[model samples]
Target chain A: MGALHEGHLSLIRMAAAENHRVVVSVYVNPTQFGVHEDLDSYPKTWETDCGMLKDLDKELAEDGNNLGGIAAVFAPTTDTMYPSGRPDQAVNAKGSFVTITPVGEVLEGASRPTFFRGVATVCMKLFNIVMPEKVYFGQKDVQQTVVIKKMVKDFCMNTEVVVGDTQRAPDGLALSSRNVYLGTRRRKVATVLSKILRVAEMSYLREHRLRDELLGPAEQLTKLLLMEQHQLPPEERVNFEIDYISLADPETMQELDEVDETRGAIISGAVKMLPVEVPQPGEDLGLSDGPPVRLIDNIILKPVKL
Target chain B: MGALHEGHLSLIRMAAAENHRVVVSVYVNPTQFGVHEDLDSYPKTWETDCGMLKDLDKELAEDGNNLGGIAAVFAPTTDTMYPSGRPDQAVNAKGSFVTITPVGEVLEGASRPTFFRGVATVCMKLFNIVMPEKVYFGQKDVQQTVVIKKMVKDFCMNTEVVVGDTQRAPDGLALSSRNVYLGTRRRKVATVLSKILRVAEMSYLREHRLRDELLGPAEQLTKLLLMEQHQLPPEERVNFEIDYISLADPETMQELDEVDETRGAIISGAVKMLPVEVPQPGEDLGLSDGPPVRLIDNIILKPVKL
Candidate 1:
């Protein structure tokens, strides 16, 4: 609720403009997280969320916008969201990965096995309860948005899915709710991710080959992004496990062994931060329990043909 | 299509009475039966089924009855019904079993685990294809009617299910297509199944405990109905394979251990006729595969409170 950022605003504004009644559900569903994942620390600011909506409503109202069309904001309790959501019907079971059938078993399915199922189930529940005609998501969560669109089509749902542009900071860092967790210095270097991707996109326009031409620069940029942004050294790259970084077919989301010009390619990546040890003398490895290493961040690059 | 009977006529009549455009689907869905169950030898009376409908239409027309409502008859090919009905997506994998769901796993779930699934799935495909507002069924398949009703409610289906009373012969043999395989003498003894249930109904009305008091008289009546009325011996009663005989809650179709005055009961049963012994000298005991022994019948009884 507190992050009254432009990226979130864009989604709300688009929904308001396009749909008959716009519903902004500000819930960070806990079911999509793994047991060690950050469910408790996820940023939520109801007052700020409400304030942003009120400001938008005032602006729209002054501009002769029908404020009634922008329906009530939905902030559901965790009880309502996760009730009977567990697979075994057990109460307060640890978090599960959200998985979607067929699609969830391939590509992203490989990394977050239960991810898409949790997502599809929760979305279906929300859709059934809300009965929304149109739902909005920012392009920042590109893979999630795509997964949802595919789910709606396959299940024959009536809702229209609208994906807004990924809003970026002035330095070109992708806007995120978790971006608030970055320190002041770490925040500036985070922009390198988008900047390096832009360079890669421009280089791909001039070349067609992957093996000898684009692979070296792409690999270098990937390493540079992790090192420069996360402040992790080359030795730490081994611990900062890169799950997969590859070019794939954009439509079916199937990883391409060889690049084809006819079909578009998506360059996506994911990594888990290795568990860090606190420097203490004879500290029992099991005694001091630090937070578990978490999986985060994904990027997508579409090839440009000049 | 030779077994032209009144049971089939009742379905047609109910369909004509209910809808502006009635489509009577007469296909014997192959997926509903188990491998050992009757599939090949079952009667296929297309000519007679059509003739009976036409004759009923004419008779109703002459009698100034409302019978002009019959619009079409849908007798689809077997391939269309089972194209994707099985659990194995590989064999008839056109996306069969689309209709049935977890709801089919309840009452009929035990005896025919896949039966209700096949029924519901085929019915859904038929319903979608025909776009019918109303569908008809005979009361003889009471469990099937109940299963379908539950499926429709669970799936939020729009079609109305109308059940016609079971049509029976003068001696009380419930009409069925499989009855065609019975010889003249066996067909006479078949009526004993219904007559025994009729006495059971009388016993229930006399405030007799079914299992404790009524089973003796019911079994005796069954033997008497077989011997005196149809000229069969007492040993023939034991030869008839009885599947299940129980009173159940009419709504949920759950078996009630003890009958209550407020709730009604359904007395249902199935029997396998004795196989003929064909002589095989010095080889093995030969059981001649006399006609299909898969005979089923049921009678519903309401409680008479003092």
Candidate 2:
């Protein structure tokens, strides 16, 4: 999926630094999207994406590095990705699919049941097609990184998975293609996702190791945000729905009641931003109508000797 | 899986001929077996298996072929194949699994629902680990060959899949490790699987293209075999249970009501052999007492101009 944002660019840049030739696969795998998810509305900035890649290559050339900059951009069509015809987004939809469970069945997968199934299946296909020695993924989708790693390990795929730190806005909103769907007000509110994760991270860093202690403030802040929105004038209010605030084992993605002192843990969450009412005739405040803009972010807690 | 029967040898020899080195995986994949299926009883002639490979290498050396004999035998432990712990054999068992549907769902799949899922999953792991230029499968497992090919194509796997002709005993019985469990009487009747497939193949070659017309004689022969077995004395009888007699498209594994003359089809079936009585103290006939020994075989019809 390519809107060529700063986040995607970071992964590409990282890949270029490591490998001599990097193949970028720009595919909005339909199999990965849920029936109601943003397959149609998902950004497709092809011309801009290509231009950005070219610009990145020029920038790398200027850097005087021996590393190759983007050898080929594999922009395959839906037809190429799913030659057996596009897979049905429904959970039970049949065809060729790769599924990783336990890890895939929690959090994001629990919310969007078939989401990781689609992700794993597409990633496997891409891995086979590109056959890259190393693959890069943004930590923005933390659980996705875990799922892919597990799939690669479990399937014995001869590819290394590299994780790039999440790129964020000045407000700490995780950079995402879906971010474009956020209206002005919703955009401001979406940062709450990353905010809560940070709060949990700060708590964990302060040695508040108990699961409840770590997640308590984050949950409280989410509730307070909802309450504050409820008190606002209905038309001006933005509804915030917190999907999950998870402190999980990074390897298995299994919810951890308490983070292992040595292994640490990943604190992550998803929040949906929805405008209470469509922007009035006088005010077009950049509010979307169909589905809420779901924002997700995560923080990795390093192990502490304490 | 390493009983090292002629069928397995054929695949190994074919692979050796095509590639510089051949890695033989001899793990009895537990994931592929159903819970009640013979996971425990399934033969584990590892020492004999290695001996056979060595013997094959000697023969290859004697042949003066430039092709390398067995270079390595990758006999991974169960823990190695399923690092996240062994996957449960139950249908709904969750883990990382690769599934090819439609093709994987019909024919043999319908009989053993999760059979192809395990096959596809394990094959993916093996392909990734070995990264072979070409892989080989014996045509004795016709449906399995189809499933693996579809998985490779669907996943865009790099390796080419080559099908070795089914190796058979003098009686036209497809050679299989499971044959050893058939005992003497059951072994004789097990040949019925291949015989019926040959009947269907002969019918197709003679231009008897109609579905029922082609299957009629073959099915009648099976029924006649069962009737004959029924007429035998209780101690002498061997049970013949036909799981299925399928005339299916070679590509999709979908049952074909009528053979597609141009595209051709596969004639296949599975027959279970069960001894009616336990071996008495005096009677030392080689008859098994546990679950029926299932034997499968198939014949491919070449597409005809007429």
Candidate 3:
């Protein structure tokens, strides 16, 4: 969880501005990853992460404003987090677990069944450990923000959940530690996730509230990308697979047929990128074998006075 | 949960004596009750419950010692507890829930599968809502205390869990709101639950550490009760059904084949009572119809310096 990208920094900065003290919890949280997903491959830049936090603190201090800097960093071992035993990655794994239903079982959760359970469980543990007055999350993971909010509301936890705006690259790719996994070509193509969400956002801004109207162009663009890749020579093709494109109620994460004018909605999606041919020896092509690199992004539609 | 018997009062008194403020929550959490269980029939003497708390506060105030009294009573409705629709009574019901495993799946949990899930979930909600420094539970519910302790440790909750000794009647029957359901004849027989637990406790103190040695007499007593009821005339018999008698590790709630003298153990059991015949018109015989009135009790074996 601690690659220390701009997205993570944004939340930290927001927390620093508001609270007298800020504690950052940097945990990979194994329970959230599916067995087949990239737990081992997930980035762990502890030294660089600390350096980044230090730099951010110095910058805040240099600004000559009274604001809280990093008070401490909570980097717990696996044993400390789970004293009983590590939770099984299986959906029905037997152990102490916190689960949010219906809200957690769609989109990302639907794709990776045990993910939200792991996220909710770990977050609950962290909240208890830190006992913070406020917790911050990046809107990059939209459904996760919704799930955590629901957990806090339903469980009556005292901490407030603050969502920071998603930080993005100049090319429009959402900032993520997993972004390092993208090879050169795949990196270029990765922006399509944000591109499609923007497409959906543009349609929403145009007052196209119907599900089909909002998602049509985005779906068509994904199909076109696949079509273009298939037309290329097999060895030259860069494959794309869209997992889901959701227009959903922000509170419940329920897929919506039409956006509510009063509450607005969130348009989110996930896509996988793969190279068709295995890389030759000494090849510099950015290609990965086995599981494809999955990227997700979302956009929030503010309620409009219609 | 608001019958306010001696068992509940002991916990309240303990809390008042220890902390500067004590908050008693009185909600018969629906999620904890199975559809066939006593959700509707469970006692709800709110006025009387408040009266008892008031009486206890007055007594605490008269002691002239510096101690806390009842600061507030949190009595949330089902809708307040479950903002999303109330969780289905089914085990696999779809909704937000907290689950503790292995520990929650044995002894009482094995008999009532969904019981601990409801308990863990509701306690989590209450803990978050109250955020008390310490929470009190009666040891009459041995498995519940163990499960809650595990949840607090595993979740890293801040509240210290305090267990009050099980308050009992002069005849050794554990005080419970459900005792009202026992008829005069069945009420006398109800003492068998504590009697069996005491039997196991006595054997443990005698260094009968093996499972069979410790539980043999207790189980035999239950068997004898059932046997004696069978020998009685059909209409005259007050039936006794032994659900389970467990000698378990107090920490994990795992059934132990042999008690570890250093760690000690807990001996607990549940028994169901039924009146074998319908009550005649104008009869005031203390008997109930429909589902059996189940009673549970337990005793702790102190760790021996072996």
TM-score of chain B of each: 0.79, 0.95, 0.95
Question: Could you give the candidate ranking by DockQ, starting with the highest?
Answer: 2, 3, 1
User: In model 2, where do residues sit more than 4 Å from their true spots?
Assistant: A276-278, A282-291, B278-291
Query: Can you list the residue pairs that collide in candidate 3?
Result: B183-B286
Docking class of 3: high
* TM-score of model 2 (CA atoms): 0.96
lDDT of each: 0.59, 0.85, 0.87
Query: Candidate 1: where is the Cα deviation over 4 Å?
Result: A1-306, B1-4, B35-42, B60-68, B77-108, B208-239, B278-291, B303-306
Worst 10 residues of 3 chain A by lDDT: A282-291
Model 2: per-residue Cα lDDT over B88-180, one tens digit each: 999999899999888888877887888888888888888888888898888888888998998888888898999999898999998888777
| Model 3 chain B weakest 10-residue run by lDDT | B282-291
Compose the digit string of candidate 3's lDDT tens values, residues B109-227. 88788899999999998998888899999999989999999999999998899999999999999998888777666777788888888888888878899999999998887788778
Task: Chain A only: list TM-scores of all candidates.
Answer: 0.76, 0.95, 0.95
